[model samples]
Target: MAVTDLNPSDNDQSFRCTGALTIGRAGSTQRELDAMPDGMTIDLAGVDRMDTVGAWLIHRTQRDRGAHIVGESAAVKALLEQVAAADHPVQVRPDLRPAPTRALAELGTWTVEVGQTLFGLLGFFGATLVGFGNVIRRPKRFRMNAVVSSFDAVGVRALGIIGLMSFLIGVVIGQQGAVQLQQFGAEVYTINLIGRLTVRELGPLMTAIMVAGRSGSAFAAQIGTMKITEEIDAMRTIGVSPVEALVVPRMLATVLMMPLLSFFSMLTAIIGGGVFCWVSLKITPATYAMRISEVVPLHDLDVGLIKSLVFGFIIALGGCFQGMLVEGNSEEVGRRTTNAVVQSIFMVIVLDAVFAVFFSSIGWL
Candidate 1:
């Protein structure tokens, strides 16, 4: 590349660039052009060829020094105009909202999402109720095979873990209670504590938690996978309700098995506590049995079974709701499964609190 400066008189100058002012031809006219006398006009008519770099240089010199282009080709002129328009830097403004305003905006958004989720869950529950009514009217449509499969999956397959967990919990509770009571020469009260708590609270609470984590998560995963594969859609198109076919069986199985599991959990826990007492406190097994019978109220067992039934319903509802919410993909299956378990466990605890308050107020304790 080459640039030649012209001066015919003092305080008047013009520059001419020539011979292919293009990148990779070994030179640029940028420095020579920028170093020219102030207000020097540039002539590009002599240039053999031009590229983006040459156009940008010409555009920049013209923009800064008011250089007059003499005989630039139309293509070069258009390129210069485009480069000039795009070269200016953009400025970004920082956020200026007050802290309280931003916080309130986030809170409002969260409230809206929560409302939508609750509304969706309600719709699913209503659909399930409709399906239930239809099945009641047409008993032949009820799927006993699916119900039995769900029972085997969630109830029979889950007993070992549930029983082990409750028994260990009872042992820990009895041992700790015995130590504390022994300090007051009241070790006999350990039996009372274990019997009442296991019968009225721990039995249902622990069993429900186990069921939620196991069955509820599975429900979300199963339905979510089916949804991703479009099986649910096929059912809908064929005039078969997916809820009736998939959800009802699981719900019925849960309702049927939860109370039975809770009852078994209660018995195992009582035995665990009794064994611990017999070993650690030198209390005979016969005496522990007598103490359990004397201390545990029949109403406590009734309350626990009732709570288990409600907990089963809530767990099934949570699982089905989240499963149906899955719109697409395997990632959503895992996400909805996690949400189902967490939501089921949360609802279980909340219901337990409500029951405690209700039973207390009604003098059922």
Candidate 2:
């Protein structure tokens, strides 16, 4: 490319650019153009070939130095016009908001998310109930195999961990209770503390939390994977109800097995507490058992079993509901799985508190 500057008069200067004004010559051409005085005329009538880069260079010179473009070719003129038209300001960063305004906006967003989740959960619960009704009306359609598999997965396999955890917890409670009660010379009441607390409160609550982490997260991951793979949709296309095939069996298994798990947890914890009493307090195994039976009332056992059933339902419902809500990609499966565990545990704790108040008011305390 060649660039020539001409001055016919002191007040008249023309910067003439010739040859190809394409990307190949852009750097050199731009350097030459940069030396031109402001408000000079840029004459491109001698330009043989031009491209977008050439047009952009011309547009920039015109914008920055108030230079008038004088070109002859229709193609060059169109390219320059197009490049100038396309150029516009773009905001690269978002505007910052005031602290209180941002806080309120975040609160509003959170409130809306909570409301949507609650609405969706209610719909899922209704669908689950309808699935149960369909099974009742057509018992042959029920999935016994799925229920058995779920029982094995959620209950039988979980016994080891639950039993071990409960045993450790019982020992800690027994040791701590004895420490405090010994101060008042009533260390024997440690039996009451261990037995009552294990059977009535800690047993079911701890089991629910563990199950939420283990089986509830599994439920969400399993169903969410099926959703991402379009298996749920394929089932529906084949006239198979996903709720009946996928959800009902898991729900039934969880509800049925929870009571058994809770009972086992209670027994293991009491045995642990009894062992601590036998070892530390010089109490016999028989005496510890007798004291536990006397101190922990029957109503307390009922309270625990009842809470186990509700907690199990909530765990199953939360996991399956969040799983069904999964969309888009595999990353969503992990997110929904975490949500399932958190939602299940939170609901279990909240409902446990409600049950405690209701039972106490009805004289079950």
TM-score of each: 0.78, 0.87
Model 2 regions lying over 4 Å from their true place:
1-40, 43-57, 71-88
- Measured by TM-score, how close is model 2 to the native structure? 0.87
Q: lDDT, candidate 2, residue 21?
A: 87
Candidate 1 achieves a global lDDT of 0.89
In order, the Cα lDDT scores of the candidates are 0.89, 0.93
> Mind giving the per-residue lDDT tens digits that candidate 1 earns over 1-365?
56666676775678887778787543447667756876787888888788888787777777788888887888778888888888986758866789999999999998998899888888888999999999999999899999999999889998999889989989998999999999999998999999999999999999999999999999988998889999999999999889889999999999889999999899999989988988888889999998888888889999999999999999999998898889857899999999999989998999999999999999997
Lowest lDDT 10-residue stretch of candidate 2: 2-11
Residue 200, model 1, lDDT = 97
How far off is residue 223 in model 2, in Å? 1.0
Q: How many backbone clashes does candidate 1 have?
A: 0
